[model samples]
Target: MLSPSRRRRRAVGLSLAMAAMSVVVLAGCAPGGSDPGAPQRRSVNTRLADEPITIKLYTETNYTLYEELAHEFQRQHPNVTFEITKERYDVLLQNAPRLMASDNPPDLVRLDVQTDQVKDNLLLDLDPYADAYGWDRFPPTQLAPLRVSESGQRGEGSLYGYGINHSVTGVYFNKELARQIGMNEPPATMGEFEELLQAARDAGLLPIMQANAAGEANMTYQAILNQLLDRQTVEDWIYNVPGATIDVPESVAAARRLQEWAEKGYLNSDANSVDYTSMVGRFAAGEGLFMFLGNWQAAALDSEMEGNVGFFLFPPEDAGRPAIAMSTPGSLVIPAKAENPDAAAYFLNWTLTNSTARQTVADVGGSVPGGDPGRPLPDVAPGSVTEQTQEAFQDVAEGDGAIGFLTNATPGMFQNTLAPQLQLLIGGRTSPEEFAAKLQADYEEDLAS
Candidate 1:
């Protein structure tokens, strides 16, 4: 019906039309075409960008991930900077009081639970700020330890510190070593645990690697004592309730039990001299069946053993009672002498709820309180160990029995008095009765002071 040139023109027009239609279809498949009214996505700035504030932070130990965290924080907050200072645990503890006494104390401080000394008058109450920032993301159980009584307030208290991570003290066992000695599972009772220790010794393996050189070595003995004595008895002994004495039956029994374990070769020969870092390495090398430590060492175990490590609740001694472990969340406090309390509060808020920051903490070998267990943790030992630790803590918190530790609950001076005395007991320098008497005398003196 048309000439050759006309036909060619028509073909070209049809091809172009089809091509245009294809483009239209592809355009529909592309993003943002169908929804013209859709809101533009905003980028989340996790750091204090453009904020003209600087906060000084003091902490113990060096962690690479924390440096990364600081960098990421700086990236998000271009105007905000951190002045960070790190020291060894003992040095940090020793310097904390001196720093707080000065006019230029650090804005943010990472304090040990036992050093509740500075917590009383040196830290600021964070109730209003925490409430304003919606820190209700974590439950009260996680926040209880950091709460302090406000000045001139009888019953009212406010959180002065916030902890990004928690540590649980418990027994870490080597599964391979356990299997070699026909122990496929962890001990559920103290008696069974003792038997396991004996078995490990018989197999020519060290049963327990205790780091007694560190002044904190007494922490282990305290943990053992907690299992033997009720919370009220411990509190009474610590507070020096009239006529209360560690020389009583309970303290004597706990000391004797520890002495028996040491005599039975349950502890390493040079345990009194081993430091914390060395103790961890020894356990990792399979030199021992079990080691008592905090979950702060989780990252190390994850990196070294991958999944060969397992955790157990402190085994129960009395029948019909559930076993539990000790848990203490590290705290971040603002010194009363802080030059920048407002900025410190802002940083605290940012750290607590920031998803990436929390994940970084978990990755670096610490567990977030009230965090989802299903989250991926790269260097974690095993989820099962964490679960068991959590379960034990929950039992202690929920059970009709009292829930707390003397080291954390008692005043700093009293803790100091007890630590060295307990160490002497462990080193076999003090008899059980004498150890109890010394504790009683210290408690009475502390209460009077």
Candidate 2:
């Protein structure tokens, strides 16, 4: 899910309360409703003082971080154990709906901002749990994206999930390669960044390292789009705020910039054939000058290159404006059919609020601490890429400029519309105007349906 500000605007507390009541009444009134005498409520011990029990957790992204937190939790409560199954995100996205509805669903699952699963009634309504656990202490903006309306629209109504971290993406540069090309410092404006790209290309080095096969070519396009458009315009488009549209002059120019880079040989000629891992590996091996990707890649780069790697948000279109990067909460949700919802919620809460978990996030997760924006972040390894990423993330996040990912605006956009359209743009098969039109058309189609 893109970060909270771009998520739909939240409904007022009373309105949300009334909506929850209505949804409950409707659920109970359906023909052949759940067994009237069946236990509809289960006891949840927040202290985890119950009999020995193991909670099954299914997750995506940074499983090591989750394992570390789980071990810490176990030290506190010896009787509680976790059975974790980590899967690739593509596989999870493909099967989450069925898995979430199974007779024995995993207690916790990572989920995107998409609301189709919520519409299917596969995820739990977290409002009751939030009340019981006093989760209102979390910043409301952070909680907004996890909410889904009764009518199935996401961003407001009933809270369904919680995130442990916020992620931001930007330019990752090989400092040595940059210095070799005589560009010693990160650019201060988009125009200067373009000049750096040309300089790298002139030196016979890969100016941009991207994996088209992994859909990063589209992300490169978005990074440029972020530089061109203001935050509110992009947010309104991504969140489906009424009257939002993507076929604007700035977007057209952003698309054109991608085509220009492709023509100028700034982007890797074989980008379409490269996988994400290989692309990162090539960059680490000194094959590329810059790679546009998320902070999640920081640990690997830092481990390999040490001080050779540096991160910076793309420069703003206006040199005077502060930079804003696309960001989202790294989120997890409980399935409606989960057998141990309480344990899962406990784990989620512990991971976000516990000091040990926060340290792990700061050190290895390549994301900012999730709970309570006012809380101080644990110090990361000194002079590390993780440290640089954490600083950049905090700057953008607190500056009120972090925006949503365009791919999350509508389901299937990354796979269906953006991936192919971007490939076409890079291949010189589609004009920028045409590319913008296709995107807007798809956006309107999804809205109409």
Among all candidates shown, the one with the greatest TM-score: 2
Error of 1 at 99 (Å): 0.6
Q: Per-residue lDDT for 1-449 in model 2, tens only?
A: 12434333233232111111111212211112465323344344455446897888777643356666777788877989888888756557667777877777888877765666666667777776676566787888788777777665657787888878888889899989999889877798999999999888888888998888746686788888887877788887777777788898999999999899889999889988887778888999998898998887787788899889988888887687876888788788888788777678777877766667777776667777777554556766666778777778767866877777888777767777888888888889999999999998998787667
- What TM-score goes with each of the models? 0.77, 0.87
Q: Candidate 2: which stretches are off by over 4 Å?
A: 1-44, 61-64, 71-78
Listed per model in order, the count of residue pairs whose N, CA or C atoms clash below 3 Å is 2, 1
Q: What is candidate 1's lDDT per residue for 1-449, written digit by digit as tens?
A: 12334223111111101111101111111122356323333222222335477778888773343444566677777777888888765567678878976778888888743324433356655555554455654656667666544232211255667776666677888888888889977666788888998999999988888776655555556667777877666655543345555567777887888777777888887877777778888888878888887666666676687667777656668656754455656677877667776667666665544557766665664454432222332222235454444434445545633334445434443246556765677778889889778766665555455
Predictions in order: lDDT? 0.61, 0.76
Worst 10 residues of 1 by lDDT: 16-25
Q: List the candidate 1 regions with Cα displacement exceeding 4 Å.
A: 1-49, 62-72, 112-120, 150-156, 235-247, 370-402, 409-415
